[model samples]
Target chain A: MMLANKQVVLKNYVEGYPKESDFELRSSMISSHIPQGSKGLFVKNLYLACDPYMRHKMSHHISNDVPLLASFNPSSVIIGLGVAKVIKSADADFEEGDYIWGMTAWEVYTLILNTNGLFMIKYTDVPLSYYAGILGMPGLAAYIGFNNLCSAKEGDVFYVSYAAGGVGQLVGQFAEMKGCHLVGSASTDEKVHLLKSQLGFDDAFNYKQGNDLARALKRHFLKSIDVYFENVGGNMLDEVLLHMNLCGRIAVSGMISQYNLKKLDGIHNLFCHISKRLRMKGFSEFDFWHKVPEYLEFPIQLIREKKLLFVEHIAEGLAKCCINFCWYLLWAKCWKEDFSSFN
Target chain B: MMLANKQVVLKNYVEGYPKESDFELRSSMISSHIPQGSKGLFVKNLYLACDPYMRHKMSHHISNDVPLLASFNPSSVIIGLGVAKVIKSADADFEEGDYIWGMTAWEVYTLILNTNGLFMIKYTDVPLSYYAGILGMPGLAAYIGFNNLCSAKEGDVFYVSYAAGGVGQLVGQFAEMKGCHLVGSASTDEKVHLLKSQLGFDDAFNYKQGNDLARALKRHFLKSIDVYFENVGGNMLDEVLLHMNLCGRIAVSGMISQYNLKKLDGIHNLFCHISKRLRMKGFSEFDFWHKVPEYLEFPIQLIREKKLLFVEHIAEGLAKCCINFCWYLLWAKCWKEDFSSFN
Candidate 1:
């Protein structure tokens, strides 16, 4: 048996943008059995979700319970939505070797106690790792944010920001399935092509190369934007506001653009939201977890039928976890550079 | 027939903030009757509403349809919502001395030919000027912005910004009549007092005195806000975004704060709207004008029963219309010192 375990832990709460310096890989001792009378599971994390919302968790508290989904604690292992195999369990419901997916840590192994809302992943034919992402939080978010909040309809026009990112990519395909015209904005040429070609977006633009995002959106969506899935806020949101149709809808899932700045960039064109009778809503997957089974059924069937597609940028090992996390954040920020060279 | 056509005309499309310099009083020839085969009415204006939304119309092409609402021609009279008595009529529907109201010019006497959707004010026992304001466009806006957009319910905690303003003041009162607890933010001691004392608000605050509008809101509403009737935007809107409850509805009628702003203010707290699953919407009165009968009955009954109260800052005559319009804009921008004298 390995006497020592390799694990990732929180170094500190990140300020501005997240960096590798914000996480640490440390060694710890682990035991298979829980401490007496403790309701804990020895979870061996198989997959973790790197999401846009995690950037919000990296910052210190702006307000008490600032984030409605979950709050972060300093000096604790950074928690995330993950798929884990229960190696051992003291709880009555969970058993050894049960594939479980819920909130866990950015670690190789964790003795998770006080589990809230943990469930066994009974749907085994699908990729187990999807429990961490598309089949999990982001997936649920895409469904709820689009369906319940925006009340999306067939033939509506959709413009998703961070279109090549985790949730946005999925949302584009979902919109198409609903018979809506889908458009998206990515940061890289490769991502833009991936959105239009691989992800089946009607059109996609590289916001980095675009001179005026409002004008660019106008070119693609000649009629007007009916729904905007806002992932990257600030100037992008501002531009989206200007191009919205009367009675348009905006879903505020994340704001990667403002996460790094001390003073967030203000949207100058918000008044257009009023003029257009636009509906802008903020949402998280937690609120709509009740609809997971109903939501998962269609997507899972789509995946098995080879109707759905997704991309995963994976890191090699526990030793590279911190840097990989940083890479995810950097990529989300539209910073294209090989941080591996520095590492 | 007195052909002395004393009128208030737009000097030019206003740039930045509107000023008295942007409007001119024009003496023009008046036609006493509608031309043959013309569908119009000649009327004497009774009262005109000095509204903040008119400010957007004063500026050139603020958006696509802003010019239509503003009638902001270089040498044309400033037009707005008003109550009038038809003095001479060629249109089949309107008769001589018939009371009517809709969109009209800020003038003493005028000819309205080719009227579209203008209605005759049947029962004029109630204040005729109320049709120009509280019982008119502002009232319709409050009803639609709250009932239709926000879908306000009993036991809901409703919050209103610019609570002393035309629409804001009425919405808070309307919510109160529905057994909802209303909280409002004004810019002065008198306005705040009026909200709590006369309008039946549960609590009220002077936004100017409170450095942190969000904290002040939290103090007033220990529970989460269910519906937000937003008028003043900027920091106030940013703060309100933080305290909204899940599935909370926000009626974004106008963002008066950013209207005259040379550069728009940023709303940093918009991300909170998603986390809370908040549904924020922008709207105008005309969008839901078909529901006017139902809207009029509730408020009219409230006024008849003396259950709902309202206040207006009238400018007296059309010669003072340009100055009054400027004062309305100034008051919206928190330049209260100037308008305070009139109130």
Candidate 2:
């Protein structure tokens, strides 16, 4: 069967901040059935996550050499992590109606050439859209960065930048659950309030208020920060280095602030890493895909017990993809494009 | 008995590059005996090590909050790692005629008030000066950084900056002995030659020659660097980040280049840490002092086997301390003050 596949395509390589004009909505015809004898899954996109890392792929000169982060070709479909339902499958592991989440294109339907990166969504009890956020890449990123990398302990002073972002929110909760004195920085006072009130963070601050981020961090952390979940890189990272306690650990999840700029901001305080004996590591959720089964248990348990809270703004339809993504880039609340209507 | 103690004292808090004018040689009288009933060792200085970290202590505004890195007070004798002969001791662990190495003042005679940091030198077979370079703090630093931190294995591509210095030389040898493909960078062509010829590095380059360090690194590292032992921070670190392989490790032993600068060179490539899944750790030998015994065994064994080579330029008398220290800061060959004549 032939289907009209609506895709959000890259207009051209993005420079500086991405505007809606950088992306174009294009509809193309595609076969709904998987090719005979080929190991491909013809899937219907349900929810597509708008993430900061996606901005890197949009850039003409992507800095990273990682194959997983290959830059997007001009006028091609933007691919991202999303929840989809398998319409037809040539692979033995999946069949029609199987809900799965992994790397998928921003379109109504996708013929997945590689099935290895995709995973069958087991627990449908949680919101299917959550598979794109807290239950998917963002959730796993928080798990790998906070739980695996930070080595966080009770009473440790934990700080997270962009704390109201998808992964940062979860990290703050995880730190709080571990009995840490959690402090988070958000771009707006509203998000900061939500982080402290709704997410149970010990303290939260609007980072945009202060010109001196180091002094801001100092005021929040009376003792000093032991663990820092770095999301907003550049100047934020430089300032955090100054307030880190001895032997502090910083898990660099994403540098959202630097992804758009032609020149990444210089981090001058790396000397602190030596003097403070700090360990700063950069990682992606892609690296920990093998641990999906191992990681799913805790967040799933928390969601079921009503212990974990997720805040997300859902944009309806593929047409809203570009504008919502632009909003997300401006540090809007965590957003996901709802394509469930196409199903 | 009273003894005339000749000393090298800091004249003032240093700015920019340290000079002989920043230090003064003074002679003072001190009792040759340990303070009565106190746990002290009256040591006759044998050899004093001049290290890059000493430059930080000389700065008027020291950046690190580490207690072990407290800035040197103006008009006070500079304290550093040195080998000495105990002439009188009230401490039970040490006695007259015992040779030891630890934190000692730069003087002909040092009455060590705190004996806790001192360690009794066991092997007298090697030159006593080896205790200041090869078998002392630099040796332990290389051990902790390379063996303990890098998780280096055979065939791994390893690179070390300041490869002919006290610590970098040992790290290069360690990488070579591990059967890794080792490359190193030094400031001078002479030091680069010493690294390849005397130090057994697979490839060595003079980082000072080419303005394009990234190109220089790429030329040396065909397969990219898996382990980077960082000594020269600043732009070298920024360049090396671009050439790192997947899952690379960087052990930040010291940032010699930034020690004297009022504003550290901005590191613009830290984002590579995420793309490469790199682990960059900053550490000091002070943190692992408890493991000194364990660390000493490996380097001492290597020295005994005649497999390890150490290059040191020794200056006789405490009067030469300031000049030698200034030379050492200029990336001159590792220098030690020989105070044995005072015994």
Winning candidate number (TM-score):
2
DockQ, Cα level, model 1: 0.70
Where does candidate 2 stray beyond 4 Å? Answer: A62-64, A332-343, B62-64, B332-343
What are the clashing pairs of model 2? none
Candidate 1 on B6-34: residue-level lDDT in tens? 88888787877788888888887787867
* Per-residue lDDT over A86-118 for candidate 1, one digit per residue giving the tens place of the 0 to 100 score: 988999889999999887887788788876667
Query: Model 2: how far is A29 from its true place, Å?
Result: 2.2
The lDDT of each candidate is: 0.78, 0.87
Q: Chain A TM-score for model 2, please? A: 0.94
Please report the candidate that would top DockQ against the real structure. 2
Give candidate 2's whole-model lDDT: 0.87
Model 2 error, position B54 (Å): 0.8
lDDT of 2 by residue, A1-343 (tens): 9998899999998998889999999978999777676899999999999888888888875444687787888888998989999998989999999999999999999999889979999999999999899989999999999877899999999999989789999999999999999999987677777887789999999776856776787789898899999998899899889889999999999999888788899989999988899998989889889988888877887898889999876888998888888877865333222222222
For candidate 2, the per-residue lDDT at B161 reads 89
